[model samples]
Every structure is written in structure tokens, then in C-alpha cells.
Target: MFVLDLIPAPTLRDVADILFLTFVTYQLYVWFRETRALRVLIGLLVLGAIYSLAKMWGFFLTTRVFQILWQVLLILLLILFQSEIRQVLEKVSPLRFLRTRKRSFHGAFVKSLIRTVFELADEKTGALIVLVRNDNPDEFIHSGHTIMALPESSLIKTIFSRHTPAHDGAIILSQDYITQMGCVLPLSEKKGIPEQYGTRHRAAVGISEKTDAVCIVVSEERSEVSTVTAGEIKTWEEPEHLAKQLKDWLGITESPSVKPKEYLKLAFVKNWGAKLGALAMVSVAWLILASQQEVKIDMIAQVKHVNIPAELILGPHSAKSVSLTLSGSRNSIKALKAQGVGVYVDLERLSSGTHQILLSAKNIDLPLGISVNNVRPKSIRINLEPLKKKVR
Candidate 1:
């Protein structure tokens, strides 16, 4: 209860602030969840927590060092995570939220894609094919010939034929079209990738890591088919299984194996720890950074006289204004105003003689969570004089 009392009652603005912060934090978690950058984010948060604890515990040297290092660390992080930062900003854009028709692979296109992959796999012809998703890989694709042709097996095979010049590079498949062929892709330098995987496989993993695109790699050495999505690689032994996987990835909806409840469960329960941690981190940070600070501000409020006898008039010697020293949370202090506060002096029972009236919290009308630490002129002398009869 004591802790609760210290917490100021939340206003509409406070609620909105929490809601917006919670949303941004959750979105950040969603964006970085699949990448190694998420671990880096967790590390940054750990550093922040340490800094906050150092400050709270009055470790002056530790706090001072962290304070000095924060600016440098911020710039370093911007340089290190520029790509992740750009992707996050793109996701949050207002225009990105505007509804648009979702693109899906047609049955014919899917069949052609599967046929092309198997044909290349059988002939031991190495090929890399990129399936574009919501995130365009145009920035990563270079030196590709613009084909803009339908995703027909004959055209794809012809482009990937061993003797063809473009067969050395990758082809990009967008909605219903082969947008580009012979495009060079960035290679993944990630450790622990199998030694058996060659340049084509590395390129597949590279593009998948950089964007939301699914990559298919047909190995010339093993004559096997492999798929990379979100930096994870999977191999399919049977063409039927690969076809099903492709259909699922393309949202073709051959059959609904999972229920809607399962999807809800996946959304909420998949990374439950990360989600809860994000919420808690934002809420705690808000308390530490926004609400818990103590501040003192001086306000001058008018001294109001109440219950004075009708025959008695206040003398000029009495104080007309009081300077109040108020202490409270930063928000409370910020919201306070001189006009909203009042110092009242009751003169109902007092006689006409000069009386020293002690000014205290009871004499002041103050908002909640605010206290008058000190008042200039703790006691004001009031002299009530009898009014003389008015001459007619």
C-alpha cells in the first residue's frame, strides 16, 4: 500500500504514454526476434539496467562512467545495426500499414517452379532462385539482366543452362514473373554452415538472412534441393514434400492443418519469455526514467481570507501572497500551477487584535501527491481593524 501510494494516479496522458511505449517495444521485439541482433539488443538492455542500478545505489563513479559512455555507445550501435534499424523503421511506417492485396503463387507458377528445381537438381546444374516477399531484395541484387518474363520452366531452364553466361548467378522471382536473372547476391559468412554447401547455398542463406525472401538452392555436387528462410536451411528429399512446403510458404492453402486457435497460441506462446520481458522492461524503464524522480518547485499562491467577521477589515500588514516550496514527483511538480494552489487564513474565531497565524499544509489547497515543504513567512501577522461607519 505504501508503494502504491507513492505511485501517482495515472492520467489519460499517462495511459496513452504507456500504451504507445508498450507498442513500440513489442514491435521492436517482433522485428529483432529472428536475428542475432536481438541478442545484441538484450545486451544493451542489460547495460542499461546496470547503469540504472548504479545510479540508484549511489555508486557515483560507476554512474558517472556509464553516463559518459552512453553517448559513445549509442553512436557505435547506430553504426553496427544500421541495416536492422532501417528495416525496423520501414516496418513502422504509416504507409506500410495501408491495406494492400497479398500476392500468392498461382498453381501453374508453383508447378513450374517445382519442375524447374527438380530438372536442375537431376542434371547436377547448380542454380539459386530467390522468391520475393513483403521485403524486396532489390538493394541486394546486382548485375542482373531484367527478364520480366513469366515464370515458365522453359525460360528458367534456358537461363540456368550450363553453357549460358547468366547460369553462373541467381534468378529473382517476383509475383508471376521472373524479374531478374544472373544477379549476384551477398554471401553469408556465418560460421557453422556445412562445408558441403557451396557458393550457391551460401548466397541463398545470405539473401534469406538479409530480407524476408525465401531462397531455393539446387546443388550441382549433391543434386539435392535446399530451401533457406529467415536464415534457416531445410532440405527436401521428395519433390512432393518440397511442393507442399512451397505451397505453404506461398499461402496457396492446399489444406488447413493448423486451427486458428493454434495460430493464436503460436503468436502468444511461441516466444512468451521475450514478449513478457519486453513489456516489463518498458514498464520498469518508464517508472525509473519518467515517474520516480523527485523535484522541488517554488510557487507563489495568493493568501485567501475566509470566515472573517463582517465588521472587521484585514490590515495591510497581513500577507497577501505566500511562496510555497512544494516537493513531489516530477510530473506532479510539472502539472502544478500557482493559480490552482491557495493559502487560506481563517479569521472566524479571532478577535480584532493582531494574531500570528501559522501557515501549514492545512492552510494550503494543494493537489494530490504534493506537499508544502516550506512556506516563506511561516506565520503571518494579521491585524483586523473595526470598520468606521460610511458617511452618507
Candidate 2:
């Protein structure tokens, strides 16, 4: 039978547990996709596959080696992806709310940002603007003039003008305000960045890689606008497209009319490869984890004699224990072990004679989702004797 058929219907808690695991897995997949940790994750998965196959095929040496590695895998992951792990913890920190409150950038702010970028692009003036999200970029801002002024298109344009002192540096915008200007951001050390892209583009990507910030960069050489986030850059050819992207990232929602085909095309057809890959990975993982529901394990349970008749005595019992095989999910089996499972033979109403008691499925007490499949030495022979009167 299939695993799902063998398993009982899920409870509300079980559903919640599954949903929580799925959400965590999806988020981790997304996070790994943008970092150097992705390659490490792929390598680990490949090793895991090999290990599984080795164990299945009875490659004892390989299996033993992999088993040893599994013991330290958690520590190895922690040491290898320490930075990524720190970033995740920082993002989920409760103290973050106390440190800074995130204010949604209004439509006016998005429009201003878009206008400023296009105006700078037209003048062939290089500008880098970093929009701070949950993470604070204050530490990355060095040798910068702190203005903490409300953002305006004219002010932004003036700061990045060719003649201005702050023109060469980046601007930091936080909580819908320009927190700093003329800020020097870290240059990206990542390889494969195009040689043609100058310090401004590198700074944009660098700050984005370090924090959850949306960076907008304007190229002086090409008069082009681009967005850098999560170490990825996308250049925009048209001002309208840049503006739409800015609005989308800045939480400025615009309800535009869309046809059914257009909706389908955007949702499914675009980036179909990534969508399909994600679905396949999640489905495979779920199946492998859930298939343990049908797993069976054999255990020996000692038979306990309970509630003996006062006038009778158990002279001899043929079978003191029975071999039992149980089928259930891994978790259920673990719980059964923890709770101390056992088999019991009741002999309270038996008369003074030898009798054979047949064991069956009904004789065992198991937890929900667990079922008894087979019991060895199905019957136990017991000889009972009447108690003789004795002098006090």
C-alpha cells in the first residue's frame, strides 16, 4: 500500500507541522539561491544522494563513512555558512523591531525616486541610492554627510549633480527619508562583475549583498538605470520600466487592467524553469519524508501477567515473551518506544488446569497510526494450580 494510505488522516497539528516545514524549506531555498552557499548546498545534496544509494546497495564502507560525516554535518554547515546563518538570525531577531521601524515608502516617494533616477540618467550623472529594508545599512555608511531630510526629487537631483561634492558618493534612504548623502559604500569583492561597470555599480551590489536593501544605480557612461538586490543586477532600457520596477519594490501598488492571457503569461510562462524546478524539489522532499509513514519495525515485547486469581497460581508459562512487528510512521514508533510498549496476558478468570491462550492483534495495545502486523508464537500455554490450605 502507498504511504499515505497506510498513514492515518492528519490532525490539525500535523497539518500545521507540514505547512511550517514547507514554508521554512521554501525560504531556505530562496536564500541559498542568491548566495555562495548555493553551491555548497548542491554539493551536500549530491553527497546525500550518493550516501542513500550506497546504503541501499549495501556498500558498507561507503555507508559507514557517510554515517560518520552525518554526525558532524550540522557543525560543518554552521562553520561553512556562518555569514548566511548570521544574516538569517539577524533578520528574524525580535530586537530588530526595537532598533528600527520600517515605514512603507509611499507612492509619492516612489515617484520621486523614479524621477530622480531618470533625471540623473538623462544628464549622464552617476547616482547610487540604497533603500534600506529590515536590515540597517548604517555601519556600511562611511565618510558620508548625514542629512536625515525628507526625500524630494529636486534635492536628490542636486546631491548627485556633477558639480556637487556628494556626486561621487552614494545616498542612503531609510524609513521614507534621506538619512545620509555622500556616503561611501563598500565595493563588491565578488568575481564575475563586468570590468566595464565602475565603482558605483560595485558599491550598489556590495551594499545589497550585505543587507536587505534595494539599490538603484545610474550609469554615467551609458545613461542607463539599473537595480541591484541580493547580489543580482538588472539594467533597464526605458524610464517607464525602471519606474514600474521601483514602484513594485517600494510597495507602491498600482491596479492596472490585465487580460486573462496576460495574467497567465506573467505568472506561469515567465521564468517557468525556476517555477517548475522549485515545485519538483519540494515535491520530492515531501515524498521522501512522508514515505516513512509506511515503514515497519520488528520488536520483542515481554508478556506481563496481570490480576492473578487469589485461589490459583501460575505454575508454568510456555511463552514469556512474543516477537511483534509493527507498522507506523517514524514519529509514531518513536513515541511508542518512549512510552514503553508491552504485551500483556490476562489470566484472572482461568480455572486450575493447563490452557492455551491464542494471541492476536486485539491482544496488543498500540498508539494511534500504529498497527500490529505479525506476532510470533501466537499462543502461550499456561498451567494453573489451586492454592492448598496451609497452617497459620
Candidate 3:
């Protein structure tokens, strides 16, 4: 009998959250790839890495640049990925990315691709067909007709046919189905686009830039079958090779066939990867949560035997920079909100042996999110003696 060890296992809830967030990140990847902003993203990532290194090594300037750029980047990202962001949200009508996207056979998807290529090459029908990958093509599909799913060969041939309704626009995909025809995709906005690039070629590059999807275009003017990925297009003629390429990209080609024992090892490793990723995410989440918590601390003015009065409490002393030393909780190390607590001691009134004063603060209940572990100086102790007379 084999007994499974659950020791050191991470919680399932954390795992699920990790996977869901991972899937969302994947979808975002597809959305961001191959676009103008993709280069910027890479540059930013590189800069971030450099900043991390600089901080480790004490290169203050590099760290400053990285920190400063972040201030402007948020606005720029929104502007650059405007269309793509909208397209992705539209595709996730019901938030499917919150869980795993189960793979189903996108049948007829390949056949249609093959047929379209053959016809476009033979008859020189300028056409583009886009396969939605990690991102959604809904925004692009809005410009065309939403049809019931159709067989690939028939759909491709008809779309390229001279008399067909969608001959001018691109075909769009969703969930392994041919969901739309004659879809209007954003045109390539790069200034260096070829002089001869017509609507079809531009659309192909445009969609490829904006999404991780594979786009196939048959150039009517050249009788060429070109594939576009990450905003770059490449041409080819071999149908068999193309089929193999599709399968490989979609991961149907030669998946590692491991033995049961090997499979167990792989699965465990995969789960470990997932757990590690989750822990990283959890750390970030914890920081965000801790920041937002009502966790607060109050600084205590380290004083002895001096009774603080109402006047000092209401106003500041002659020294603009007051040196206060007090403690309430761990949060006190960096922050002590005025509303959380306040104290003022009458520095002149002290001729003391020992004195006790009640400590008070507003909302000592700690706003909402943080718990106070320890209160420093539960009683202020003052050791007092009679004031000595000054010699004339």
C-alpha cells in the first residue's frame, strides 16, 4: 500500500488563487506582445532589473532613474495599450480567465487555414485570418458579422471567394470556433510600414502586434502565404510544414511522453513551481494588505518625572524640530499619525523623585486593520526631587 505524504503541502486555496492570477498574466502577455509598447515593456523590465542591481551595489543614480520613471510610466502604459486592453476585457465576458482555460480541439481551424492559404496563393486573394490566442479578438470582431461556427474549409474558401460578403475584412476566432467574418482590426500604425502594404497586410501586422495570436495572410498581389507573429510577418509555401508548425505552436506536437514515475516527478515539480509563484504573489499581497491596514503606532517622548500640561499639548515648543522618543507598537518605527495619539510634557515643571502619568490617544482601538501587540510605557515614570536654589 502506498501512502501519499501531504507534509509541506501548500494550501489549495492559495494554489487556486495563484493559478488564476497566472492565467490572467498569460492573457495579459498575449495582449501586450508584438506591439509598439512591447519594446517599451522590455526596456522597462530591463531598467527595473538594473535598478535592482544598482540598489544592491549602492549605485544611487540608477536607482533614482528607475524610481522616477515609474512616476510617468503608468499614464504612458494606459495610452499605449488602450485598444488592446479594451479588446481583452471584452473577450472575457464572464471572467473565464479566473480559472484555467480548458483546451478543446479547435477543429476545422487548421483545415480552413490550409484551404485559405491554397486559394490565396493559387487565386491571389489578398486575405488575413487571425487566430485568437491568449488574448481576445472581440473588439476586432465588432466590425464584422458574428456567424454560427462553421467548418474551416468551406468558411475559408467562401471568405476568399470574389462574391463573398467578408472578402475584404479578416476572419476572427474565439474558443476554437470561427466566430466572426470580415472583422475589422486596428491598422498597423508604424510609420515604416511597406509602401505597398494594403489594408489586409496592415491589418495582419496590426493584429499580430496587438496580440499573441498567429495571423495568416495570403497576399493577393504576390500569391504568397505569410504568417505574422509579434508584428513581424514571414512567408512560406509548404502546406505540410505549415500544419506541423501549427500543431507545434499549439503544443499538440510531440508532448513529452513520460513513464508513470516520471510523470509523478514532473507533476510534483510543476506544482512546486506553482507554489513558489504563489508565495511570491502572496508576499506582495501581504505588503499591500499591511500598508492598507489600520495598523498604527504612537511615539512616546522619553521623559522622566515631568507632568505635561494642556498648553504644550496644544502647541509646539521653541525648538521647531522636536526630539521625541516613544513607542507603542512595531508600526511605531516609521509612522505615528497625529490622529492616532499625541503627548506633550511640561519640561519646566520637573523636580521629581517618581511620577506616574496616564497615557492617552485618540482611537487607541487602532483604526481597523491592525492589532496592537504591545503598548510601550503603559505608565510614564518620573523620578522627582526638590528644585535646588540658584546661588546669587
Candidate 4:
């Protein structure tokens, strides 16, 4: 009960405000998850929490250090994550979802891709193939001659053969078309790569890490087929599993194994923890910044004379307006309407004479949780002249 008392009662506006904040926080979480800057964001959040705790518990020294550290950290983060920040901004564009790609990767094209990959692997010929997804990989790839031919097993095999001049570089498959061949791709610089993985495998991992493209690398020495996505590599020994993964990634329809309702339920349950975490973080931030903190604001309230006697026709007073001091939670203070607030003076009880009326909290109208702290010109003196009777 005490804890509930500490928090102001929830209103419809409060509910809507918090819900909007939660939605924004969750969307930000989703965007950051796709970028390499997520870890940096988490580190900053952790430091913020520490700073808040230090200030709350009177750890002045630690609080001061963090205040200075934040400035330096911000500069460093901007310098280090410039590209990642740009990528995140690009992801936030609403038009991106509306722009759809013309996909030609059907069952037939997938089958051709499978055949071409294994055939090259069986011949111990090194090959690299990039399958473009939603993200355009043109910025990361260069020096490729455009082909734009239909994806066929024989054609793909011929291009990757040791005899062809283009066999040394990679081929890019976009939608249903072989967009380019002999394309130079960036190589992964990440340490801990296996000694067996050659330049082809490194290039596959590199491109996949930078974009959403799937890279398939065929090892010439081992005659193995491996797929790289999001900087991770997996060797596919079975054709069925590889086909299933490719279909899932490329948005190909498959025979349904579960009901529609069950599929939706599984999708919701897939990342339940992350979704809950985003909501909880938003709630805590709202509580600290808006719900608990109290702020004071000064505003002017116009004086309004009500229920004046009919016999009293004239009035002269300096109490045309009064300055009011109000205090409440930050949100409540922000929502106050200056025009709606006024000091009402009751004149029905007084006779036609010079009289003074006291102004207090009772005379002013205010919203819930907001209280009038002080009022200037605490009392108003008015001179009411008696109405003169005119001869008829």
C-alpha cells in the first residue's frame, strides 16, 4: 500500500504514454539486434544503471567520474560505429518494407544450385557462390562482370570449372538470375579461422557477416560443401537439410507440418525472453524518469469574479491575474493547462463596499496530484460602487 501510494494513480494518458514508450524501446531493440553495435549499446546501458545507482546511494565520487566518462565514451562510440549507425538508420526506413524484390528462386533454381555445388565439390574445384537476400551486397562486392542469365546447373558448373577464366572468383545469384561472376569479395579478418579454410571460405564468411546474403563455399582440397550466414559456417552433408534451410531463408513455400495457430504460437515463443526484456527495460526507465520525480513550475492564473451582487455595478482591483506555484510529477506538471487554471472570487456574501478576498489553494482549480504551492497577491481589495437609480 505504501509503495502504491508513492506512485501517482494511472490515467488513460499515462497508459497510452507508457505503451508508446514500450513500443519504441522494443523496436530499437529489434534494430540493434541486427547490427554489431548491440554489444556497445548494452555496455552503455549497464554503465547508465551503475551511474543511477551511485547517485541514488550517495556515491558522489563514482557519480562524478561517470558524468565525465559519458562524454568521452560518446565520442569514441560515434567514431568506432559510424558505419553500424548508418546501417541501423537504413533499417529504420519504413519504405524498405514496402519495396519488394522480384524473386525468381523457385524449387527448380534451388535444385540447380544444389546440383552445381556438389558437382564442383566432387571435382575438388574451389568455388564461391553468393545468394543475395533482402540486403543489397553491391557495396561490399566489386569488379564483377554482369551476366543476368537464368540460373541453370550446366551454366553454373561451366562458370566454376577450373578451365574458365572466371572460375577463380565468385558468382552472385540474385533472385532467379545469375547477376554477376568473377566478383572480388572482401575476406574475413576475424581470428580463430580454421587452417583448412582457404580464401574462398573466408570470403564467404566476410560477405555473410556484412549483409544478409547466404554464401556457399566449395572446398577444392576436401570436396566439401559449406554454407556461411551471419559469420557462421556449417557443412551440409545431407541434401534434405540443406534444401530445407535454403527454402526457409529464401521465403519458399513448403508443405505445412503444423497448423496455422500453432505456427504463430511458435513464432511468438521463439524469442520470448528478448521481448520481455525490452518491455521491462522500458518500464524501469519510465518509472525512474517520469513517475517518481517531482518538479515545480510557475504559471499565471487569471482572476475571475463570480456571483457578484446585482446591486454592485462597478469594481476596481489590481488582482486581474495572480502568479501560481504548482508542484507535481514531471508528467503531471507537463500536462497542466495554464489557460484552464484561474482564481475564482466569491462576491455574493459581501455588500457594496471596499472588501478584501483571500486567495488560497481552495480558490484555484488544478488537476489531480498537482497542488498550488504559493500565490502572489494573496488577497484582492475591490471597490464596489452602488448602482444609481435612474428616473423613469
Candidate 5:
């Protein structure tokens, strides 16, 4: 009989970990590549670098100013990237994730889709496809013709070929299917989109603002490809480069798996620089609650043993020592003092063996056993001189 391999594979685990990081790094990178906030993000990084240098060099005042600015910059980035982040989250939604890989990527059929993109780009074809995410874009889809899912290259080429019946309008890519063709997205009227950007870019930005879907544009005149998410679009991108970008945004990467470290990093903030506002909000909540509650009250006191002159039977036998501490309402605690607190046990009643005691303060009272359970006392020593037994 052959024995099974019992040894751990260190190399395999390391490979798995690295592969996880590669996927995460790529995913984080792609999500930020084309959005309008990329510049501001760079600026934030520079500020962070400066802040780090200031900290290292003991420039406390300069670092303090940077710290404040960094806080604001962080919030703006979140608002700026909200649309793109929404799109990526839609891809991660459980209902959409497992069901769409066959149609979206990994399937050999996607190769045909890539081929069609190349063909469109080579011929300087202009087109827009707005993918609907999570929340239904039924209103947007109603504006266009409905179609059953079709094979990649042929159908994509047919629509944008300049010869097809619906070439003028944009396609709507929904989970596992292109549910409609020629969908008309409301063009973003906001001034944020540059005037030089074409309708293709406009539609990409528009649909992204309205929904969490990513928009891909193949510019006919420029022969350039761009993607829009979260109300921001980047143009003049190469088709190959855009492919990697989408793959990363779509949760595909050079590595097929995820790692614990990457998952944790992604969990807090795929971009930590962008999450301080949320943290500040939490801090504000804590402050508000703290301001309303009791202050300066921390502990209560308890008795250990009792001493009496009447009982001659006093030896090591004594009730367990109880610790007294300051506690309760602010006024009560403020008035309390170690002198005001006193431990008392009825020695006449206590048997020769042991007895419980009471600890009382200006307004505080503790049950017989509570004090010892709570506080560890430094010392509670009671010496008793037995009451002179009247010589009878």
C-alpha cells in the first residue's frame, strides 16, 4: 500500500498567496485607471507622501495642516469614485457573479467579442454599450429594441457596422445577456463631462451616473476605446489595454484566485485614502454619545473583613477582603472619598470560622460578595483587640 503525502507544501502555499496578491493588485489598478478622479488621487498620494516625510522629520505643524487637507481629499475621492465603485460592486453581487461568467468572460466565446472590438476599432467605428448593473435598468432598456443573447463578434459587429438597422443607438449589456440593442441612455447634462468628448463618451458617462453599469465606447473618428463608470469617462484608450481593464474591473485577473490579505485590504477600502470620511462619521457618532453619558465614574468599593473588641476569637479568620472604588452618578462619584467609604462586618454575629461583610459609601452600597468579585484589593488588614472579657 502506498502512503499518502503527509508533508506540507510551502512552495505551493506561497505561490497561492502571491497569485492572490497579483489578482488584487491588478483589480485595484484597473478600477482607478480611467476615472476622472485619477489625477486627484495622484495628488492625494503626493500629499500622503509629504505627510509621511513630515512625520519622519518632526514637522508637526506642517503635518497637521496636511492631515486636515488629506481628510477632505479623502471624502472627495469617495464621492468622485462612487460611480465606478458601484459598477465594480455590481459585478460582485452574488446574483450576477456566478451566473454571468459564461457570457461575460472566461468562455472561449469572449475571444470573438474581443475580435469584434478589434474590427470595430480598426475601422474607426463609433459605438456605445452601457451594461446595466444590480438594480434593473428597465426604463433605459425600454428605450431600445429587445434581443435574445447573441454570439459575441457577429452581433456586436452587426449593430455598430454602420450598415445595421440599429447602428445609431447603444447596446445594453445586462447580466449573462445583451437583453436589448439600440437602447437610448439619457445623456448627462452636467457640465462635468467635457464638451470635446463625443456622444459615445457622453452616453458612457450618462448611463454610469444613472446606474452602476460600466460603459464601453469605441470612438469612430478617433479609433480609440474608452470606458466610463460612476459619471466619469476616459478616452483614447487602446482596445488591448481596455480589455485588461475590463477584466480587472470584472474581477478577472492574471491569477484565478483571491487571498486573505488582499480580501482584507479590499474590505476596508480598496483605497484607504478615500474612506476617511466614513471613519470621521463614525467618530462623530461616538463623540455625540460620549458627550451625553456619565463622566469620571469608574469603580465601587467592598469589604474584606470585620474587627470587633468584643469577640476574643479573632485570628487569621476573617471575611475575604473587598475592594472599594469610586463609581456611579457624576455628582455621587464627585462627592465620594476613600475616607467616606467604610467596611463594616458584625463581629458578634460572625462565627469563629468566617463571615461576609458590607461596604458603604456616601451613597453607594454593595452586596456581600460583589466587591471581592470585582476589585482586587492591594490590602485589607483589620486588627482587633478583644473586648476585655469582664472577669466573671
Candidate 6:
């Protein structure tokens, strides 16, 4: 039997809980990446490492201080990055009206959007398109004209034309429909915005920082295409690459044309560093936490009668098993439970009607790192009877 069988099997609810937690963690990592909160998260992990080490080394004072800090760490983080937390919560909230929608032609919409963006880039016409997701960007909608029209490449290009009246503002897209056009967005008040970035870039970053919307901008001066999401902006030179990124951000899956190996290679080459770093961090954290956790378990071990003479017939014994309490690290205890431990009694030299055999820690064979702390019925009484001679 596997070691896991020593414990109760996980239910469907447990699987669901694990999957939910994994999804949330991935989302949080994506949101925190390229943001100031990344540094805070690293610092917290460092503190956790220190606490684990202190606990393993039995440093009471240091461990106590870290434990106290851990108790208030959540509140402290909330107070320190209240704005960033609010933004993330708003993006993940289900109550946002922008997320309530029926399924439509997502593939066609993504293709049209990509085609329109590249067309505007080639013509040197500037465009800012905001793709709203969970968060409602309705506050900025009143500042512009509401189109509520189907998404099409030609229509998008005409709306963003240099001579058009709506060319100066942004167009808001909800799924496959154009919700609004000529919408003036909130400009980012964040300091240190580069002088090269015009008002459009700042506005794109502003809306992205406040919501979960993906913003695409085509620069009029350089005809460069850029995407802004989660307060970070990345410039793309190739139209295909830009299109692929937009499809990914919008969760639009393309036809399965690429081979599995080629897709894996591309994924690895894209973000291997981040993926490896996350794996290493999780491994180290698990090690530290596991090493510091101690557990005590009470188990009943059978007593084995060994080295008994053939002439002796064993009679009833006061106790056939002993209760043992073992203490060690959780891993060690689990292994011991899986493998099982037992106590032995030597009756080769005993020829008694009633005799008590004293049991101690030495009587039981235990695995390394595990120690017996308590044993019930420290001694056992054995009653032996001699075998009768057989008549010929």
C-alpha cells in the first residue's frame, strides 16, 4: 500500500478546493507581476523563510516575533497597498456589470480587432482600444458616443481614421460589440511617465490599473503598436505576435495547427525564467515549512513472542499489545505509521507459571528520528504450561 493510504482519501470537495486555490494563486501572480506589489510579496516570502528556519532551530524568541508579525501581516499589507488591492478585487469581482454577457463570435471579433490595429499602424493613424472584462468602464462611456454596434474591421478603421471626429478618443469594446466610441479615459496620475509617451499611453495605463481591461494603442508618431494591461505596457513590432498576444489576453483559442512539441518549445522559450523561479520558490518553501512542523501520534503495536523453547507451551498473556506514543516530525511519523513498528519479548530462558516482562523504549524497534515518549501497561504477565508427554 502507498503511504498516502495511511491517511484518509481526499473527497471531491478537496479536489475542487485545491483547483480553486491554484487558479486564484495564478491570477494573483499574474496581477502582481511587473507591479510594486511584487517586491512586497518577495519580502513576505523572505520573512516566512526566516520564521521557518527559526522554528526548526528552536529559537523561541525569534519564532514568537515572526508568529506575531504573521498574525497581522494581512492587515499590514492591506493598509500599505490599499489602492493596488482595490484594483485587483475590482477586476476579480463577479458583481461587475461588464462581465454579464452571452456567448458570441469571439474568434471573428479578435481577428477583426487585430486586423484593424495593424491597418491603423500601417496608415500612421493613432488608435486606443480598451477591451473591458470583469470591471465596468461605464463611467467613461458618458464622455463619448455609444455605438452598441457589432465589431468589424472596416468600421473600427473608419472610427479611428485621422480625419474622423472620434479619432482622438478611445473606443470601448465589450466582447464582440463596440460599447462606446470617442470615449475620453482617465489619465494616469502616476509619476515618472516617460516624455515620449503621449496622453494616450497614460490614459491606457490608467484604465488598466483601475480595471482588468486590456488596452491596445497605435502610436501616431512612430506607427508602433503597444499593449497595456495591469499597469504594464509592452511594445510589439510584428503584427502576428501582437495578434497572438491579443488572442491570449482575450482567452480566445486558435485552431490547433501547431504541433504539441512546437507549442511546448515556444511556451518554454517565452517565460522559462519565471516558471523555473516559481517552482524553486515553492519547493524551498515546502521544505522549510515541512521541517519545522512536529507531530505526536499514539499507536497500538502488537507484541511478538520470540525465541520460545519447543517444550514450552505459551498460555494466556495479560496483554498481547502495547499502546505507544511516539513523537517526531510529521514526515517521520507518517513513514513509521506506513511501515509499522512492533515490540518483542524474549521467552527462551523463562520457565515460569506467571512472570512479568518489563517493557521499555528499547523493547520496541522504531525508525530513525522517531522516539517513544509513553507506553501503556509497561509490563506484561505471561503464564506458561509444560507440554504433556505423549503415551505410546
Best by lDDT: 1
> Alpha-carbon error at 302 in model 3, in Å?
7.6
Off by over 4 Å in 5: 1-106, 122-124, 131-136, 149-158, 161-165, 173-178, 186-195, 206-214, 229-237, 244-270, 294-392
List the candidate 4 regions with Cα displacement exceeding 4 Å.
1-4, 8-36, 50-75, 106-108, 143-168, 186-206, 219-223, 228-235, 240-260, 292-325, 330-392
lDDT of each: 0.82, 0.79, 0.61, 0.80, 0.59, 0.78
> Best candidate, TM-score-wise?
1
Q: Rank the candidates by TM-score, best first.
A: 1, 4, 2, 6, 3, 5
* Candidate 1 lDDT for residue 175: 83
lDDT of 5 by residue, 242-269 (tens): 6666666554565457899999978667
Q: What digit string (tens of lDDT, one per residue) describes model 3 on residues 111-137?
A: 556766877688877777787776665
Angstrom error at residue 204, model 2 = 2.4
lDDT of 2 by residue, 126-168 (tens): 8999988777788777899888888888898899988899889
Query: What C-alpha lDDT, on a 0 to 100 scale, does residue 13 get in candidate 6?
Result: 67
Q: Model 4: per-residue lDDT, tens digit, 248-365?
A: 7777865557989999898568678876777688778767666546778888888888887888864665357889899987656655652368788887877887877788899987
TM-score of each: 0.66, 0.58, 0.46, 0.63, 0.44, 0.56
Clashes of 5: 10
Worst 10 residues of 4 by lDDT: 1-10
lDDT by residue for model 6 over 220-325, one digit each (tens)?
8988889999778899887788777777677675545899999989866766666656555654554445543567899999888887778877787546888999
